[model samples]
Target: MIRWGTSAWLGSLAVGAILAATVTFAGVEDRADAGRALPAPTLSTPPTSSPRPTTTTTTAPPDPCGAVAAGMSSRARLAQLVMVGVDPRGADDAVDQVRAEQIGGIFIGGDAVGLLSGGALGSVHATASLPLTVAVDDEGGRVQRVDQLDGELPSAREMVARYSPDEVRALAHKRGAALRARGVTMDLAPVVDTSDQPGRTVIGDRSFSPDPRVATAYALAFSDGLRAAGVAPVLKHFPGHGNTTGDSHLGSVRSPALDALRGTDLVPYRSLPEFGDVTVMVGHIDVPGLTDGRPASVSPAAYALLRGEFAFAGPVMTDDLGAMRAVTDLYDLPDAVLHALAAGADVALWSSGGRTGEVLTRLENAVASGELPQARVDEALRRVLHAKQVC
Candidate 1:
């Protein structure tokens, strides 16, 4: 476990802030728990498809973890790793939780407009020491949440059908700007799954194409737009959830063999480096060939693949752990949060259930008892602070 003296923390914070500001001022422009059963292998090994060329100007800010570490208590820092959903009716309660528990972020869903309007979100923001990462699922089509407040945008599939890559980027810029105007700083979008199968339901309209190259093109374009608009974009369902017929929200889902995944499921992620510090959301689907029946969200092997093979260095987040039956049916919310963090996810997203105070308490106890390592917590906290700094 890692420990730091108060003086060391303070010094590091000062240095971190200076480095962060220097990097920014320089204007450097860069351009589910367990699987019930193993699924049958479907596709044969296909030819490799290279990602389409795209440019991005953003780079990660200098590490700000020390600044957060020096300023907050352990409980407060741990809270930064959890993202909870809020109800419009209980907006006041949510604000209280933010101040009392030092909750890291808030997600608006279902009637988001009602919950966030009239300075409701601003009221919550007023309670935090650091800027909270206010996020929404604004992927367009059926997955949009806040668009109900403004107007509708086309789905990923529809955008592909009607617009060029440049057009899609323009639309995403407008959407991202609109979300930012409402105090939202992050967008969970640009579904990168490459599912072209005729009957695929979970990701049918959300994905850009069945072709990996096309998906790569649109993913980068959408991310660029979001970054330009000042809202961070998150690439969803990592390791690919488009090929599966099962919905993780309902039950367990499985992927094909490891070799087959390279050509299809892994393409969009391979192209992630081009997008700078964009976040990646790991799904609940199990890949038996890779993880040996453990859900990707809770399996160290899956995260190792992402960090070791793909070289993803940004914040790694989990899909809604409380809402999905794959996890809820197996482990309690707190236990699931521990598993996800231990497996390398930096953010444990609770879109439906789980109280922020209770989650923070459990995480604290786990760390105290060595069930979770302090180093792990520190690393996750660093990534979380890094994300906030960039936003």
Candidate 2:
């Protein structure tokens, strides 16, 4: 690990971020039997010839996952890791990108339910080539996306503080079921961040508990519940996003020290099982030894830490690419895609923007330039397909 204050650290951080964000799934499997674990579904490996394209429909629609599995070429597959935004007011270009770019997925803002339900989600599902994983931050409290119409629930801290783990489990199960009914497949939830900082209201009540053990228990329960409801639960802000004074959505954030991260912060995430079939969401926070002061979404050491040390084999996604200030201020759409893939990320996400198609084009160019490895692209596609089958 490079010292936080050293100049040598900058080079490693840049390279790591680029690679980690480029590499990075679909799924609906039943886990309704309470604690019983279900084996995840397998994604299709690359084929010599692409499969025949499926037709779209209103009643049956296309098997969104199947279309994505077949339509993406090797280079396009590499580009799919990027999840860019679309105009919340409504736009046709996003649908066009879904079809032309064969995008990996999309991120919808908290207020996008009307748009998503009206036509946006349906358009992406029916037209996109790959199994597009539609996601939102519906973690309840202030992060609830669907609550504008569905009504917000209690904060995680409040829920855990007032109720039992089983109560949180029930709430998560209900939330997941609701999302699934509306055609949303992934919920970026169960925060799992352990905030120990004083008056740090940003992550406050949203996190399950300040104690890693309690937070871990609640997170596992929430994940199990969501999975049972056929909605994938994403454990977020990996290695932990709780101790930061800065909010990544607004600007860059760094931990006070490595010790602050190792103790209470990462306890819940590190304590979880292999989390083999889970989807882990990376945050934009900058940590010294882990992210080397770059965002975790595009950090090599961050990737190595999550995949190599934590042994979390599930799909990895970034917090919305459209929302993070670090990414928005530094590069254009395609450059973000390249940097993310190179950093070992499986998904580059955005939740608000009109340039989603342009972003996709940039990713395509990078693949053509051989800046990213084709093998990594293939692995990401495989994982996506597998997730859809098993999760």
Candidate 3:
């Protein structure tokens, strides 16, 4: 049961004051040099279990591709790179595509919990020829998807208010388990952006803390706990989203000076190499030096920084194409998909508007015309398939 009381209240706490007072931990050291001497987790000892299972039931059959390494596949592979939105109630049009297209994954909204639990997902799983990575943004507090049915969980900032990084991890663990029981396989979560700028009021409480070290620690904990619960975790707004003032959902946004971003905003992504398997989500921020005036989702230079500088080999996904300010009403829907893939983004996440097929068809044309290199597509597909296989 969620403890509801004075401890959980967030309104009384002034966010700006808390942020202004937050002490920056020493500049982050290489994972090796952080002097904190906590013992590493071992297989011999496990954390306490959550509430018991109501009944022991037969387990689902293992995936044949479970242990198979990721590789290029004409059909299965192409589907992985296309992450599309399905109707929260699981519309027939969505199910048809899931089966025929053999899509790699699906993103759901809050209303989708009914579809997931009430046989919509079960039927799709039964009908689909290949495994699918079903994901949702249940980041607690503001970005919760299952709250309407299961009750609201605390926000990321709220959790940080009441607990230490360790406790936040435990909360994420329980949250992951609940989603898993409802058949969700992936969590688009742990907003790793260091929310400090006054202009970033939108992502204010969505971020863990203004302190990079605190942000990194809390993010790593959530990722660790989700994986422990058999749910894949994605660290988002890569390169960074913290320094930007405008909401990407509305208009084009840019971060503060590249120097300031390097020092504070990117701490979480920089820390991921030591954190084990983690997926990074690219935001739509336009950093002057890194993106060269284009949004990060549509910039090759931004992708190179994440792949080359950060050395993040796991999948890299773009934020919602529909929400992107660069994608406007005047442009054809398919161009959004083409531009993002061409720019080096791997997974094209939730098509906010209803034009997923239009985008997919354009991608197919790009493949046929040899505009988008087959190698890049193959690499992106491989990453997507590997994620689905793991899920």
What are the models' TM-scores?
Answer: 0.82, 0.76, 0.77
State which candidate has the highest TM-score.
1
Candidate 2 lDDT over residue span 1-391, tens digit each = 1010112212222211111222112233434655875455456654223434444333433444445446556557665666666544453655766776666666666464555555456666766544566676788777787786566778787778778878877888888777776657777888888875543476877888888888888888888777777777788887678888677767888865666777877776675573335788888778876677788777878877888867777678777666578677776656766687777777777676556557656666766778776666666665665565411
Report lDDT (CA) for all predictions: 0.78, 0.67, 0.70
Off by over 4 Å in 1: 1-64, 198-200
C-alpha displacement of 88 in model 1, angstroms?
A: 3.3
Candidates, ranked, TM-score: 1, 3, 2
Residue 390 alpha-carbon offset, candidate 3, angstroms: 7.2
RMSD of 1: 19.5
Candidate 1, residue 189: lDDT: 86
RMSD of 2: 18.7
lDDT of 3 by residue, 1-391 (tens): 1100111222232122111222333332345546866566589966333444344334455443332324334445556677787777754745776876767677786455556666566666655555666778988877888887666878777777788878877878888877776767778988888885442376888888889988888888888787777678888887788878687877888887667788877877777776676678888888877787777887898889888878888888888886556554323557766777888888877556356556667787788788888788876765664554432
- Residue 146 of candidate 3: its Cα lDDT? 80
